[model samples]
Target: LGIGGVRLLRALGLNPQVFHMNEGHSAFLGLERVRELVAEGYAFPVALELARAGALFTTHTPVPAGHDAFPLDLVERYLGGFWEKMGTDREGFLALGLEEKPWGKVFSMSNLALRTSAQAGGVSRLHGEVSREMFHHLWPELLREEVPIGHITNGVHTWTFLHPRLRRHYAEVFGPDWLRHPEDPATWRVEGLGEEFWRIHRDLRAELVREVRSRLYEQRRRNGESPSRLRQAERVLDPEALTIGFARRFATYKRAVLLFKDPERLLRILQGPYPVQFVFAGKAHPKDEPGKAYLQELVAKIKEFGLEDRMVVLEDYDMYLARVLVHGSDVWLNTPRRPMEASGTSGMKAALNGVLNLSVLDGWWAEAYNGKNGFAIGDERVYENEEAQDVADAQALYDVLEGEVLPLFYAKGPEGYSSGWLSMVHESLRTVGPRFSAARMVREYLALYQKGQEWAGKARGEQEVLRAFHQALPAFYGLALRVEVPGDLTLNGEPLRARAYLEGEVPKVLRPFLEVQLVVCRA
Candidate 1:
């Protein structure tokens, strides 16, 4: 499909200067480009070099299974003739997707994409570091921190996701320029909200409650529930309750059932005088029966614990439901295991609508959390085991809910208003609204595209250099180099030295092939 996509674009007379492959799924585009270059009278190796210069790839998955791979026989069956047309033999083409292990029959799409792209990146800062370690095999001579991948944190489309009510309010306060400058904190103008803001906020909550009740009643009716039970949906959730929303793709690493780890403790918190309510919605993959079973268990616990009115998971989650939850909920919850989430963007949508985030510091939360703008789940600690991590995170959730979240939320001042909670809401809106919008993301991409185009143009202009480098590829294949750091290494505002031991068909003046990085760590 990826190869066909490139062909289709060419048929339409589209000459893309930079090929941005969002993931390995479309990595075949790189191969197609090389084939095109070969047809234009370039040698196979030189074609690969030029094609790589014009390619950029972004990796979004940290887990191994998230990557796509295929059997060698399958690749040959599909692409054998295609490679043959480019004057490349079977083994040479197969080597493009080679795995490092002894059992190397499978071809990794990610490996092929990494080798072919001139630039690569992860979706967030932490994910960039994680990606470097994950793909360091491609650059064995470089230090871990010196791996080439960078990051551009994910963002949300503010106008598409922001509530209409909030949009109107923002426009009134900051003028129509707010729409164009949604990433600017000054454009939000939280101070201008005044008393009318809370009134409208209450109305938004009431509207969300009505929307959920209507959807739930219809779902139950279709499922053959009693009419009496269906009617009870009208009183499902309180509009004024401290609502915490947890919604995303139903993956186990997200730990959707983390709060239910201790039912008794969760019950205690929910049964308080100023009780809290939760809104949960997500869909498991079609083949993910275990995820579906977890969802069923969660719903059963809600009923068995007699907390139906305080919690509900809407059916067939969609964009409309996401808008309702982000706009109406008082708090947005995300609990992905550390370093597993690439760049979760739902919480950014929630924060844009003045919803406070209570999330584990992973993905974008690692960069966004400021101790006051949002609540943290746990300290940045990597536990030795999954069970230990779950226990610690659950306890931290309970502690924050009881000690900080609930207290501030239910602390009514004048006319039943929690000024402290409102202050946090304002801060979240002010800080995150501008920083995590699609406008900023597009600008960053444009800057990177300019850089990529310049690099590709240089490579295209210097064909002789590319031909020379291609000729050197075989000698560089199995070369090994060792480095030794000085014994008295220190960073007390002084220089450090290291010696390299290169042993192979070596190239003199090896400055182009060698790089040095000094790593500093606390004792």
Candidate 2:
């Protein structure tokens, strides 16, 4: 489908100077481009080189199973015709995507993309590092750090996600400049919004509550629940209460059940003086029975404990429902397992709407969470076991909510506003709003394309020099460095130096193109 789309565009005279693959699914486009080049009398190597120079691939998966791979026979059945057209035999064509397994042959789309693209990347900083290690076999000629993959943190389309009421308020207060200059964080004003901000938010919450009541009533009627139970739907949540929302695709790694880990603790928090309500919505993949079961368990627990008045899991999650949750909820909750989430953007949407995020320090939050801007779930600790990690993180979630979030949210004054909490909301919007906008993401992608084009231009007509340099790249990649460091250092206090040793040798032919870098992580 991706190749067909690209070919169709080309047929209409749309020549893309830089082709970007968001994930492995679109990798076949690179092969299609190669076939086009080969038709123009270019050798396979030259075709591959030219096609790669104009290609960029971004991989979002952090786990092996998440990638797409097909067996050789399957690929032969589907894409066999592509080989002859590209002037390659089956063996030569298969080499582009073949996995080096000791077992049966499989052609990995990710491998194909990595081999055919000038650059590749993951969605976030940590994911980029993970991707380099995962795809190292594809680039044995380069160290993980030297792998062409880089990162541009994912972002949300702010204008699309911001609630209409908030949008109007922003325009009224800051005028039209903020929309055009969204990259300028200072342009978004939180001052003078004051009571008007809370009023708009209160109205959004009321709207969300009404929508939830209508949906719940309809769902009960469709499921044939008792008339009395169906009638109870309208009384589900209070618009004035402290509301937290959790909604996303129910992938197991997202840990939606983390909040329900300690049922009694959660109940106590909900039943406290500063009582809170939760709005939950998500859908599991049809084949993901465990994910479906986990979601059902939480919903069942909510009903079994008579907490339905304080919590409700909406059915059939969609964009409309997502807007209500993000715009209406007081806090947007995300608790994905550490290092597994690849740049979750729902929290960014929520932040732009002036809803504060309370998430695990993972994905975009790893970079966006300033201590003063948004709340983090736990310390950055890597546990040996998932069970231990879950327990520790669950406890941390409860602690933060009880000790900080709820207290501040309920600390209302004569003006009927939680000034302290509102201040944090202002800071969150001012800080993360601009940083995680789609405008910024588009700029980063264009910059990457420009950089790739420049490098491709540099290599043209220098093929003889490049060929020798490329031949010696494997030996250069095999080189290793060792460093010794002190066990501990003070925060912003010490200038530290480490002893280093270099190992391995590169071929003399590529000395001019080789350089080594030693970096210290200031973060």
User: Which number leads on TM-score?
Assistant: 1
Clashing residue pair totals per candidate (backbone < 3 A): 1, 0
Clashing pairs in 1: 183-434
Q: For residues 1-523, write the lDDT of model 1, one tens digit per residue.
A: 3788999998999888888887666999888988999999888888887888888888999876788888889988888788876668888888788776566668889888987888899999989989999988878878888889998988889998888887888788768778887767668777776566677777877888888899999889889999888988877998888889998888788888899888888988887766789989999888988888878878888888898899998898998898899888888999988879998999999887778899998999999999999899998887879999999999999989988999998898886668888888888888888888888888887888888898889888988777777677667656876888778557688776778776776543343766545565678
The runs of at least 3 residues in candidate 1 whose Cα sits more than 4 Å from the true structure, single-residue gaps closed, are: 100-104, 473-523
Candidate 2 on 1-523: residue-level lDDT in tens? 2689788998899987678887666899888988987898766676678778888899998887889988899999999888888878899899999996677779999999888889888898878887888888777867778777888888888789999888888988989667887877778777757889988888888888999999999988999999898989978899899889999999788888798889899888887899798989999999999899978988898878888889899889998999889989999999988878888999999998889999998888988888988799997776779999999999999999999999999999988999998899988988898899889898999998997687666645565565566567777767787777766765566776677665766578876766645665666
Prediction 2 TM-score vs. true: 0.89
Tell me how many residue pairs clash in candidate 1: 1
The best candidate in terms of lDDT: 2
Each model's TM-score? Answer: 0.93, 0.89
Model 1: per-residue Cα lDDT at residue 428: 86
- Candidate 1 — worst ten consecutive residues by lDDT sum? 507-516
